[model samples]
Target: MQDLEIIASAGASFRPGDIPPPPDGGIEAWTQVAMGWIVIFATWGYVNSFGSFQAHYTSTLPQSPFQISWIGSIQVWFTFFGSAFSGRLLDAGFWIPTFLVGAGLQLIGIFMMSLSTSYWHLMITQGVVTGIGGGIIFAPSLALVATYFEKRRGIAIGLVTTGNSLGGTVYPLVVRALLPSIGMPWTARVLGFINLAGFILVAIFMRPRLPPRQTGPIIDWSAFRDTLYVSYVGGLFFFVWSVYYTFYYLASFGQQEVGMSFADSSLITTIINAVGLPTRVLIPVLADRIGPLNTIAPAALCVAIVAYTWVAVHDVAGVYIFSIFYGIASGAFQSLMPTGVASITTRLDTIGSKSHWGSYLGCAVEYTLRGAIGARESFEGWLEGKD
Candidate 1:
């Protein structure tokens, strides 16, 4: 329940040379860190729970998969796109306003979704509004993790990012259970209330380690001129593309190609997410010891290979194996990305003046869109017997 003002006040006391060493055995420090993780989990949970909503919307609306998909797509797009903007704001020490605006947008979007009666309504409410909201909420979580921990940065990031996996697991089951009883509108309304509560908790507890004035952009445009940064960005593009595609399509693929029942397919998706929860925590720890990119490259390659191989598998066992392996690999890739970015941007503090977090995040989102397009194309091809 600590406020940003309190965090800032504490941070302000430290001079450049007096910056306190990372705290040890301090329950307060741990609590602050935990609160940041909670915020991340809440935000990411909403983000990853899209599959649950996607399934329900597809079933209930039937005429609007395209539109419903937009809800998630836009959420993700804004999540990444908004990061660019929010990152800069966070760097500029507007943590309180950032959190408030994000929480408000998310709450409004959820309420709006509850009233939606058509595809366009969902698109505007869920896609644009909610997407924007989620994006704002997500930015501070990532930025704060970096500010808090240096030695265990990878593990910390991974732990926080695992919230997406946990959300993916829990939200779907909630939707699946509620859909047959309360129906979509009520389910959405209930979800809105839940999001409101979660965001309130975030506003109460999440705080930045650095003072507002000392906090500035960690992102640098000139870094992109470095071949290593370009490679990292390009690699991340493909990595995110593959990650989203697998998440979006794995269930459908199981049902269609592996002959799994709908219940079974849903279970498979849940299992994949569940398995990812641990990987989200573990892989980053490993990356911390070895190297993030070194770890990420292999993990990504494995995902691409295993994902394609899933196309050839049959029955529950094959799909299950694919789901577990692919999930772990994909989860590792997700955990390592930010670390990879951080590793390349080591001079971030010095280069803060020229930082354009928005532009960098915009590039990442562009790649995400490209990935989504590729997934759609693959789905279309599969439907047409091309794959």
Candidate 2:
């Protein structure tokens, strides 16, 4: 009992030297990074392409923008919030089962989403079910990167995160073509198959190196008392809150305000993710060299400026320029948030715990503001910046 109390008390304050050495670079380690990349490609990629769906729903359905946004909102909420549950599972050494179930659920969710016709059906399957699976896959995919590449952790994480950018870039374009010709049901089914391919690789290659320490409480509330941890969490919450606003609404803004074709509007999203692909890789290399916080802090400031600047653009050229800057900046933010959390954590083993805390709370920040009551105001996006 006393030993347990001592561990609980020690919590996130433990020393870093206690951490086991990572493989740094070997065939197994690189394979894990590749697997993590595919994992995010299957999950976050879908989330990144939500704007394409949002535009279609707003134009086709009788549902109000407020109602439609909720679908995306719920999915986003669970994608991050569900991590609170799955991260603990990973920490307890249930890697194989947790990952398999997550991949399976994602397969089911996407297939179910294809059959959805009503608002509630889409919300339940695509928004809730898929998001939960995303959380399950996400926690372990991220944690393994930290485990395998102690010295190049940032670079490894950045590589995996680029999958989000790649999926975002590819999916919007793919769906845009399919939705116009093949239609929604087929479009979703095609995406499900893509996810299946990634899942196979994940089952084959993804792994964790160390056993769960189980060294302390599932959550170390005591870590909240640390000024650095607290400050980092606060900043991350606000930064995350500010992101995706651009991604979700940019397609609508292009078509509605600038009078672009649906194809052109969707292309705007493709541009952002395309620009992000290189940025995701390059910025994390910088993060490793200069430290994640120094890299993250400046990147956050750049994104905020880009977010508010959306109001001034009234032309395709201006929007294109905006996409270039926002993609690079936002990519840095997405890649760095988990990396940043991992940085201030006192012990390597506790990194997953710290990440879930920040991500769960950050989802709350976005969800509360994006709720139905203030829905239109929020989705107008950029706050006096769009719509």
Candidate 3:
């Protein structure tokens, strides 16, 4: 009892050398993975379901599809951009406090979104506030889980990432089933309750394993010096730049281009997310053997090929087939991304910091560029129709 008390009290003061190595497997370590699953499910999983919101908002709100997409884009931008700060906090042994603040902001954003009546209101609450909240907690939780396993880190991250698929699948269903019956405010409230419950569990159970890495700059300027790291991050930037295009716009495409009803279009988002479930888990197991880098390179190539095929999809049957293929390809890449980052990071303690830098560069920097591309694509399609 006294020993447990001492460890708990030592938060933020103990040096990295005093801490033990990752146990790699145990009830406690696996429990962190479980908690991480909840975190990912609530954060990225919810983000993945934005297509549902996009389609709904396009109809009910006075915003153009391009304008409505900014809500989701800014949400993603905040989540990715804020990771650098929050992740450093994790390394500094501020995990509990950081998580509490983040979770609180997230819940507030969601509940407030229920009352928002206009585009700017939704942008503030759903896009900025909620994105900030999720950003604070997301990378830290995954970094924490990464610290629990070395050999199995790939599979561990893989399992936790399955939350992305399930959350994406479930949230849309919730919106589809309840939006017409209960209305948008109630639907948003329900999502809030679900996130609130999961966060409570995460707070109670997820404990950080490493003592604070007491001395290091948060930015880790040294990582930029590594040749392999820079190259990998450069590739990741392009992938993140374009990868979300389908997840965010596929449903809108179904309605406008494929001539599907809103309900069926929403299902397109769900199918894309759901089909990812198996690949996200299984591909990491393969990555564990061959190396995360090797596994991810091929997976990324597959995702690109599948995305290019999107231009050819013109009918309802083609849409379904495209969604399934893209979901599997993207899921495999998504599950491996963080694991790949962890593999390259030499020091276990810097995992959070490095992962944050990678994500910030990949997701945040890519967002604005991707948004411009989306706008240009929409305009070109409009002009083609005129011809």
Candidate 4:
């Protein structure tokens, strides 16, 4: 009865073509941006830090690096793929319940991950559980923030995404400091607490600005008909595939190929993420001026070029140099992706569904390819070692 009443009240206030324009700059609107930052920090930030986990798991577990990466892979898979359902829920005004469930699952997954003793246990707790939690909230939060700003969407998104790079930076540093002294379980517990605090802040302040957009297909089939939309989605799929593979393997490459110590290699992950902070903030300012697609095209090319430069980098100094350049380019591309999607989208109500669905497909496919190729390489290495 109360739910129906609430819906009736909302309908009374909002008419089909009478929706007000986004405030673009105000206390309430900006507050949503701040809370969106926290959401990204907790979700993607945690996911981006998987390099730290990948390195540690490889050394301790009986599984190969290929096997250990599935933990991160599966986590990422769920986070992206699950967005298809969660995005539609956001469109329907289920934000509170969705946010609560996502927060609960995240806390549960991380804390349970601390206690996990085997590969399968970690896979279930960290990969599947945490991934689902992050996926459920991540897209909706971004879309909510985007709805609050029209002119400044690029910078707004860029600001929120800095949490991704920063989270990646902080978690690795925490692991480096605590892992040797306290062990993996305690380190994970501390990280879980950090996420708990961030989620609390988000739940208190963040809200959907527009009234519930209750009617729409979950999968906007019409989006597939637009050539530009199809092309944009296809481009992002390949970009994300390459980017995530680098995130997962860069530290391991430093250790295995460059003969760096564990401590030094972990620092490589830190450097890659840390250097991205400035670019994440600065590039979106440009995106807002020239347009997100204009900003993204060059940034993607720069990342691709810098990625290839890794072939020439064989020393400690060279690796650090590569990390800096790659981080800058990649950060620019990532921070602008959603804003780019928003730029192309015409309807405010469908932004959540369209923006998430395309990128989510990319993310899911990236993990699949990573697992398959990594498994093959790992098998060949094992055979050679046996001989």
The residue pairs in collision within model 1 are: none
Candidate 3 to truth, TM: 0.92
RMSD of 4: 7.1
Scored by lDDT, model 2 comes in at: 0.78
**What would the C-alpha RMSD of candidate 2 be, to one decimal place?**
5.1
* Residues 319-361 of candidate 3: C-alpha lDDT, one tens digit per residue: 8999999999999999998887787776768878877565566
| Tens-digit per-residue lDDT, 1-387, candidate 4 | 334323322322323475677888899988998899898888988888888888888788888777788888888889987676787777789899999998899889999999999999999999999999998898889988888887788899999999899888998999999999999999999999999998888888998877788777878889888676777788888787777767777777677667777788888788888999999999999877776767788898999999877777777888789888988888888898888777767666677787766667777787767655665554224323321
- Model 1 residue 140 lDDT? 63
Instruction: Point out where model 2 deviates above 4 Å.
Output: 1-19, 372-382, 385-387
In order of appearance, the predictions have TM-scores of 0.82, 0.91, 0.92, 0.91
Q: Which candidate tops lDDT?
A: 3
lDDT of 4: 0.82
Q: Best candidate per TM-score, number?
A: 3
lDDT of 1 by residue, 278-313 (tens): 878888888767667667777778778877776566
Instruction: Please report, as a residue range, the 10-residue window in candidate 4 with the lowest summed lDDT.
Output: 5-14
* Candidate 4 regions with alpha-carbon error over 4 angstroms: 1-16, 376-387
Residue ranges of candidate 3 with Cα displaced over 4 Å:
1-19, 374-387
Model 2, TM vs. native: 0.91
After the best TM-score superposition of candidate 4, give how far the Cα of residue 113 lies from its true spot, in angstroms.
Answer: 0.4
Better of 3 and 4 by TM-score: 3
Q: Which should have the higher TM-score, number 1 or number 3?
A: 3
